[model samples]
Target: MAELYELSMLLGDLEEQLVTCMRCGMCQAVCPLYAETGRETDVARGKIVLLEHLSRELLKEPEAVKQRLENCLLCGSCAAACPSGVKVLDLFLKARAIINGYLGLPPAKKAVFRQIMTRPALFNRLISIASRFQGVFTRPAGEILGASCARFESALLQDRHFMPLARIPWHAKMPETDEPAGPDKTKVAFYPGCLVDKVFPDVAKSSFKALRHHGVKIYMPANQACCGIPALSSGDRKAFMQMVRCNLELFADKDFQYLLTPCATCTATIKEIWPMMGQYFPPEEQEKITALAAKTMDITQFIADKYVLQRKYDDSVDKGGVKVTYHDPCHLKKSLNVHVQPRTLIRVNPAYTFVEMDEADRCCGMGGSFGLQHYDLSKKVGNRKRQNIYQSGAEVVSTACPACMLQLIDLLSQSHAGIRVKHAVQIYAQGLG
Candidate 1:
């Protein structure tokens, strides 16, 4: 045995941050997984207890600790509701890194995230090939959600109603852009994260159209890497750092006042995780990373703050016209304290009556890898969200995170549920006549 790597060095830094958790148990009230499982380990309080144990060396089993850590949605609900202000995100992210560091990456994910994801060109090429071959191997399971099931019992496909990769990724289609920021306007560098670039290219296009409609100067550089959420969440700090370094170099000295991203997960990771992990870097690099983090903002928040919407409110409902519900992504709402802005942006479109779903801010159980690692639990949690969406009786369920859209589609599609998953901006952009 090479001997499992020790986590003490990193755990030392997290001690003070973990202490702030206070074991308040308030997180239970809001955590979606906890709501479903009723397990302390599934909630923030339980996760905190595990961390305290891990830090104190009460638990020697890194795998056990890692499993508990992975049980979370990383939705930031507990952090949002925490009174003592525990940096749950910092703790969980670092904890995940600690455990992943010990066990090493799984062979399959290592092949994909490490060999493939780290290299954008190869990653894009591989997914493109998979997209073309998908039809031969997969069959439609649900037409309502445009979801497909495994054509055969392939070990890779599992039970996923995966959103097939688009024929042309955004980067392939839009290699780069430089269409003048027009007049004296602060140019924004928009970073549409991987899913938006690949799986939901139209969402990225709509975001681009909406930005242009607002007359904001935009500069989207090509070859942008993953924002490192997947790597970081896996505890492969090396891969995460690779992604960060790649992104930093990509947007080097663009003279843009803001870094805007349509993806909620990307926005939160840039705003919160970038500055956080920067502490380990040398002073000069740290300063630059800190500055970059400061400039990043969610597109919805940026639009709400920077542009004034010319509202077209029709107070009358024309026979149940357009019922849409907004689901708050944890990163956008909890991590960023930005729940109302997207809703406000939604309301700008008077044609649709925006009805808030029950536990609108609840985790949709996507949690990036949480869905992959614990698919059974993911669906168990997602089923609740599906019921909530059905309960809301809204024609559309809009959220900022594309990952959530994927999960919602899987759940809604399988149940033969009549609901549509969408981005709030997509709804708003549709109203931009």
Candidate 2:
């Protein structure tokens, strides 16, 4: 077991950063978890106070503090809304790392993060095999939503409607590629995050279509590792850093003008969190992170900014455009300030009508593994998003993040809302005719 003194050393680095919090209660208005629980301890302000106390030895139970820290959705809502510009997510993440270091990770999470997640090839192979048998345990819950629930009685999957893994994952489809720049003379290294690679390969295919349509060259290396967000968010810094180094080793020497992904979480992780967490690394690794972060872009942002400029926005709604509503993924909109570009892609398609849902920017509550840890709370947050979607009265709903897409599909499927969920890239790619 790790010692408190060790945790203090780790958390000492966060004290100066934590002192910047003003406790103005602005975070309360935006924090999804706080809104649901109505507990001060659930919000950033409360967490900051607790961190301050723990750091000074005022709080005896580091376990209690650890629980509070893990309760967060990490959706960047409070951080986005903070008036004093508090690095709330950064602080919480570092603090979680401190607490988790001392307290240790749960056995299950330790196995997943350390054994399965860090080993990319083994992880993919296992998931590929597991994907074949998942259908045996789960029966279709919603055809339109593409979701499944446990076939029989089971405590683990009680009533969850989840998107099964793709029968053929993205990597299996296009194992590797190194296409030179097309007429546009632009090359990109594509990073399909885990969810997109194993669960939503269509998004990857769509991204490839959009890229090829615009004459962007592709450098998609096979057996790409996880984005390290899962390990980082789980407070497994060792695993997180290992995964990061794995990716850097793969992508560092690649010649590409941009690193792109359809997954909003992947985009935000690479763009914002990578640079933010690079401080503890060596100078060379830090420089590599900075360079990579500079070139990373969400696929939608890349398309709207670079490709759409060359062509006119299609205004051909006369073709009886499909009524589609957009869900602003918290990672894309709040973390990276990428709000308009996704909608712009929908509008440019001319095959879809972009409808704005109520509280479109609110979190879908699929904080990667958060949903698995606290299903009831996750469902409560997700239900709010479902209500907003149903109220929008759109036939189809789209979001940029695969995780958000998973949550929406689950919520809508369980509610029997009969709405189709899709990634924004899939919608745009289908319209690329």
Q: TM-score: which candidate is best?
A: 2
- Tell me how candidate 1 scores on lDDT: 0.81
- Give the C-alpha miss distance for residue 27 in model 2, angstroms: 0.8
Q: What pairs collide in candidate 2?
A: none
lDDT of 1 at 358: 88
How many pairs of residues collide in each model?
Answer: 1, 0
lDDT of 1 by residue, 1-433 (tens): 3223345667787777777776768889988888888888888888877777774443467677777888888888888888888888898898888777777888887777778788877877888898888799888887667788888897656888878778888888777886566686768898999999989988888788788898877888877889999989988887888788888887756778889888899998988898899866778777778888899988888887778554544534444558888888888888888877788777777677877688887788998988887888889888878888988878888888898899988887777767878887787788797
Badly placed stretches (over 4 Å) of model 2 are 1-6, 56-59, 310-319
Misplaced by over 4 Å in model 1 are 1-7, 55-59, 154-156, 310-320
Task: List pairs with backbone clashes in candidate 1.
Answer: 97-235
* lDDT score of residue 74 within candidate 2: 92
Q: In candidate 1, where is summed lDDT lowest over 10 consecutive residues? A: 310-319
